[model samples]
Target: MAQRSVRASLARAFLYLVLLSLLSTGIAILTLASSLRDAEAVNIAGSLRMQSYRLGYDLQGDRARLNEHLTQYNQSLRSEALLNPGRFWVPKEVRERYNAINDAWADMEHHIRQGDIAWYHDNIAGYVAQIDLFVLALQHYAERKMMQVVATSVVGFIAIFTLVFFTLRRFRHQVVAPLNKLMLASKSIERGKFAHPPLDTDLPNEIGLLARTFTRMADELQRLYRSLEDKVQQKTLSLQEANRTLEVLYSCSQALNVGTIDRHCFTQILQLVRQQEKVDYIEMLVGENWLLCEGTQQESVPWQSAAITQQDDELGQLRWQASVGSPPMPLMQSVASMLGRGLYFNQAQKHYQQLLLMQERATIARELHDSLAQVLSYLRIQLTLLKRAVPEENEPAQRIIGDFSQALNDAYRQLRELLATFRLTLQQADLPAALQEMIAPLRQQTDTTILLDCRMPTQALDAQQQVHLLQIIREAVLNAIKHAGAQEISITCTTSSTGEHTAAILDNGKGIASLSEPEGHYGLNIMHERAAQLGGRLTISRPAEGGTLIAITFRSSSSDNNDEK
Candidate 1:
């Protein structure tokens, strides 16, 4: 027979299980039927012997009982229970004993009919003895038959037990063991182990197929992992190059903030890149003039140069020379791009000034659209409702008109505040003076006592940092005065000994309750943005003195202190 797979084997095993169950049932039934038949045969044989004795007694002394005894004896000899059908295997010795009993009965009956009392009485014992022999034979046969049944039952139980044990063992080896291995492999995989032990695949079974599939899948994973490793390496190199480009650009931008993006800025940029990165030679060329050519001592080797472009005009070129290693083409390009912007340094300053003007105007427009516009629209709706209520000079109509008028006046004041904010340029580059000027108006506008604490270094912040710091302060103070219903607002700008600067706007307002600004509020957001521009952390909290405290703390050019406000 061809080797069976797991499916066929499983089916065969199940069939065997069913067969064993049926065989066990059949054995039980056979045991019961055979035991019953054997017992019945023994019982019939014993009855035959008793009937013979009774018949003999009747013929010798009691003739009235003779008929009954004779009828029973004849019936037992011919009983289907004893002489069973053709299917029954009757012992030859048992048949001989039955024939002897029949022969003895026939002789005794002839004597009994002739009225020979002495002959009949003497020969009747022989007839009964033969019947007793037949009884003994049948009893032995029944005992033997019972023994056979016991042996068969024992054999069947042993066979079934063995079959079940082997079936379970086979299942464990073929299915359970393989599954356990797979589970172990899965656990190892979780721990980042990829290599797995090979399972048996020679068996043309489901487990074998699974093992083969797992092997293929594992191979595929290994291939994929190898491919990913190569890609990751390439990506890592690309990312490192990208980071270098960004660092170069950032250093260039920082240089531009202090110095114009001119010949001087390019020299600082090339020097900054030289300090951390590998470079043999870097030169800035403005019409063949080497503005910057600084790096390690020159080793004669490969050189690359990128054009420095400003808009559509090519102003100059940035050059690099390496003995063995040249920077990536992209990095060179990025550095060139950085140098290109610096080539038109004067124009960059004008562009920056233009951007600031545009930003200030945009901020004013945004504030109007977000705040004053909404209030005016609401007032317009109220005016429409008021006209509808014109006929009725009710108190509600008067209240509506009053609210409309109040909203209109508030909107006008907001528009004025917005205009005043956007008008002043922070060219003075003085934090204390700007804060004082900003607070002077707020102080005149409100009953709030504005205390100014100006203990900052004279040149701690640059021009733009000062401007952003002042704006952040103005925004904080404005919110406190307008929204928190503050009675006294104190502004503080202090530089600690550790060089950290703290700018705080504290007010005796409803503190925490006013901190959760309503949606569409831009003043708070603008304050945060300005603080971020100053490289400071902004905080708004309620101090124990019972009002909102908005503070910004940052590191100045001369200091290195962490944010704490």
Candidate 2:
């Protein structure tokens, strides 16, 4: 746990190496210095033998210069290098040899001075041998000092190499390995992961602190990256949902805004909702009328309902079976509103078509009255005149003339009735309203109690269907008024779920004798023809209470007829 620094450690290692180097250098210097002048001392000692022989030669051959040679020999014996016994390199054997040589030289000198030639010659060789011993000692001491210097140098070099090897290993562990880890950690962070091994924060170096800081930074980055990923996923889901919602709304709007909106169109809209929203069941109801329905009802689930409304007018209720979660109310409401507008537009179109048809019928009636009806009236007048012009006694001709006149009158009356039927005035596409208007004028002509009941849906009939139905009802009512003389009359109209229409006129008057048409009356035949035009059959029955009941059943429009259009 010590606060060790890389710089300080390196500095200490360097200083230790310097000290080791200095110690080795000092030891080599001291070792080599001990042998200083030892070589010179050996040379000077070897020269002493030569100097002794020269002195002996002088004693034998040049006795005139004998003192001079003796002075030289004394100087060589006391030479500073050889005679310094206080020096550490100087050996005791060399010094003892020097003392013996000096004592023998003193005796030789005394003999030479006393003229003893025999003593001088014998001691000279012995003295030379002692000098040889001293020189050999100096040589051995110098060689030993050189060997010590070599050993010291070798040890110092090995120690320095060992310290360098250990120092480099420590540097690799503490510095290089940790820096490599940091590099790998940085690369992992770049790849959006933290996959590297843990760093050694316990290291006693600056790299340890740096590793700890980097780890915390990496942790923060990873947390932020995860949070960002979660947000992106949520946003993707939200956008997908919004896109589906838009698709549903756009499809529904397209279905409702077409030119001829029908049950099929609404059914398609319901299908769009089912496919997009995965709903269980859906249906539309206008009052008690089910306009369009899809899917089966599931009693286990509650129904979610929205009003089919337009401009504050709630035309119907749209209901669907959904699970526990609430359905999209706003989208449903928008579809319902579009349905309401479609219904409104459908009614308006029907009314426009009815108006056009009525106008065409009125124009045809005016043309027929101006041409055919006028011609028939003129023919009737001519027949009357011809009858009066005939002879009074001719009975056969009179009978023929009277029959012709009656036939003309009947044809004219029928023509007038047909014209009135064609000129049927209508202000709206409502069948019920048209019925009421038709009955209003008849009510003024009859004191008979009359009742009307119409339960048919307004959208059940087309313009042609309305015309045929009204004509049939009028003929039935007129017949009841004219011949079924007794009392009450009732007109009832209804529609089935399968779009079949039924109209009945019941009377409480004299019952007809037969279903067959009477010879002179064509009203029954005409009513039957009108029913046929409606793509239906008519039934006439005499009730037991003595009244006639006339009823007609038909579809609003034949599929074959619509296909032709």
Candidate 3:
């Protein structure tokens, strides 16, 4: 391809050179032919002038001689007539001479009368002078013509030669030379050198076009090579990072297998994470309820269900609450979720574990109530009977009975409280009725005045959301009574314009600590967590007027809450 291109270029150059040479030669030849023709015409006029001058001079001499002979003939006739009458022979001689003279005169008169000789002699003289002038002009013209021919021939030769030389030289330098360089560069590129060659800059014609083409090709190749290199490097780095992550996952799985089901296992998991990956806080929760374990009390630590399922029914989630150098929240959730998928398929197992735990606690509470409480009651009765039977003098028996009765009463009370705690674990009841039930208990138990300032909407909440909202309100009210030292508490439930359900609990007492404390304020955190689990939010704020307000909000879907009639 390169050779063909080069040959084609050379051929074009040759054609151009030939055309230029032909044009130069043609112009020179035309000028020379015109000069030569002018020189011939000048030479012919000079010859004609010289001949006419000689002919005029000859005619004038002939006319002068003829006039002299006529005068001599007239003298001879007068001598013959005056001398003698008897000399006939002399007269005849004279007549014969006269006849010759007459013939001569007749010839001269005929010549003069014809006017050809006179005109010829007069014009010849004029032509002779004209010839002299013409000779001078012809000499000058010949000199100029010779000079012009020489000058034109020299200039024409030089111009043609110069045109031919430069044309051929340019053809070689422009078309052939650069094309040769380009071909060599192409061959080198084909052989894998990939080095760019210098382009010819001397020619501003077609060769310049070829050089630019080559330069563009080189630039494109360089760009493609660099792009491919970048892509390969990026892919390699990505694969390396992926491999490292997989290794970490494998190690985590091994550690899980070795650890136990207690708090120690949770600590071990946290330690492994801390040592392996730089993290801000790590927490391991046990059982379905995410029961807090010792050494995992950092407020910043995120509490998420473990990724691995503890039991067949319970799923485990591991979350990173914060990282020393990483961005917060949703990012952490994404990372934890990705890692968690390897351990647990879904959160259903976690709910199952929670239910099982609830069942177990209930069973234990029932056993304690049936057996331990009855025993304590029997003991108290025996102590009362013995105290009555003993005499007033039996002080020792009285004291022993009194001590025994007190001990039995304490045990009975403890059992009753445990039973109440267990009973509270029942599923959520109706909203208004459940709220009324909770308020009655509060009124009976504490001196604090509790008021329900609720404008219940015609709509109701979903079963799950209602349960969560009630739990959050219960926790808030209890916390207010215990911590805030509130004398009066107001609970209000309302619906928002967008069909959202809102419940607000207001306490007129010292506000709780800021919500920043994660573990210390368990009640608020639990409330927030429950709200979030039900797709709701809990906001706790203290007003400048010296009261703490806790509000819970949730969405009321048709399945969850009845629409307003």
Candidate 4:
């Protein structure tokens, strides 16, 4: 970008130089031509004046000679001597010589006729002197004009040369030099070195401004690079920490898979969690249901499970409560209820293990969805097309080829779709928009009526809170649709009194049977987890009518409070 800017600037500078040179040359040529023409005119005028002076002199001399001849004839010679062939008007050279000798001859003749020789001589001399002065003035004028013409030509040449030379020099220094520097800097930056600074020197006019701007741009780029480096370093540390946590989680999962359901297994899990440098405490409960606690203990409360009918004719409940607080009476009651459910169903332990695995897979699927599924879809399409282009060979060959291709495509598409579903569960947009879009697909796939009564505040929610609320609401609605077996479901969201937001999913279906049973639902667990992560609470209840209600509440942002204020 910098190089392009410099090139454009240089191009403009070159054009300006060309125009200036043309203008200067044009003016110089005009002045020089004018001077030469004036000089030629002066020279011609000087020559004409000199000739006129000589003619005047000759006319005077002729008149004087005529007078002298008349005088001599009267004194001695015969009258016919005046017209004698031998003495015809004197030879042209002699006449011209006599005229030169005596200018103003016509005036002299007029004076002689008036009998005023002294006055005629005086007027003749004065007139001759005036002609001489006029000739001298013309000569002086011509000489001066010639000198001026020469001087003008010289000056014009010098000006043209000076303009051309300076223009080219300035083009090279201000334009070409800066352009080359920009190009070199760009190339170096492209090769991973961004250290070059722009030239800071006295430049011609606009070029100086451009150079300063380029320098500022370089400084900004350097700052951006430094900021990016810092962010990358921080992200690297975060990823490392995440990886270590995953490793430990993996190890625990493997141990759970190998070990039997016993106190030792639970204790081992708790010990491993506590071993974490960042963790403060760990607790586990097992019975008809189970509740595990990790990190610092603030409070625990009794759990109540919403009753959900299973395909099997068994009446059981299983719930898991994980909290980061001291054991409270209500939480302990919730845990005791979950333990009662677990004790009734021995498979509860295995089910809990599966839930953990599902959570991990869900997380992994999300990552794959964001990074790899798109690529795999493209590959699957390419492979399918390639397979179609190939002809069916012998029976065995066709069978093997078909089976392999079908299996690979099926696996690819299933993995892609699974990842996509997990991503949808995690990602969110505007609450109203997301709810509308989610219902579109659910309405197409299921017979459940998903009614959204979302009365969000006048101001929109923050992105993080919006996403969290959307996920919670989605999970609640899906649970109602799948487990409650409801033909109609309603989700209503509204701002709470203390500037908190709340969403409720209500269904006119089966409700909680016993205080310990919770609809045998995994989504309930997910909703609870999401709510906890958002520093909120999730509640499930059976209304007086035969239906279930899932309500979630979380604190609104400070900005929302300010808006209310």
Best by TM-score: 2
Candidate 1 positional error at 104, Å? 1.7
- Whole-model lDDT, candidate 1? 0.69
> For residues 1-565, could you state the per-residue lDDT of candidate 1 as single tens digits?
2255767877887788778768766866775676566666768877765665666567657687676666766787778766543444667777778777767778776776676778866776777677778878878777776777677778777877888888889988888888777777767666767787767766567777777777787777767876888999999998987887787668767886765444456567778766645777777665432244577556556667888777777866777777656667776676777677655554445346545864776688778767876777777686777667677658786776777677676656656666655655543333566667667777887887888988674333544666677777877777777778887888877777566878888888787565655543456766777788887899988888788888899876542332111
Please list the Cα RMSD from the true structure of every candidate, rounded to 1 decimal place: 21.3, 34.9, 35.1, 27.2
**Residues 24-119, candidate 4, lDDT per residue (tens digit)?**
566656545534433443344334334433434445656555544445423321122112224342234423323442355455446566656557
> What is candidate 2's TM-score against the reference?
0.54
Off by over 4 Å in 2: 1-243, 497-499, 557-565
Worst 10 residues of 4 by lDDT: 76-85
| Clashes found in each candidate (C-alpha, N, C closer than 3 A) | 0, 0, 13, 33
lDDT (Cα, tens digit) per residue for candidate 2, span 102-188:
777788778877767777787777767777777777777678778889999999999999998899899899988999999988998
TM-scores, each model vs. reference: 0.35, 0.54, 0.27, 0.28
Candidate 1 vs candidate 3: which has greater TM-score? 1
Q: What is the C-alpha local distance difference test score of candidate 2?
A: 0.80
Model 1, position 263, has a per-residue lDDT of 43
lDDT at residue 11 of model 4 (Cα atoms): 71
TM-score-better candidate, 1 vs 4: 1
Ranking by TM-score: 2, 1, 4, 3
Q: Please report the candidate that would top lDDT against the real structure.
A: 2
User: Which rank order by lDDT, best down to worst?
Assistant: 2, 1, 3, 4
- Model 3: lDDT equals 0.58
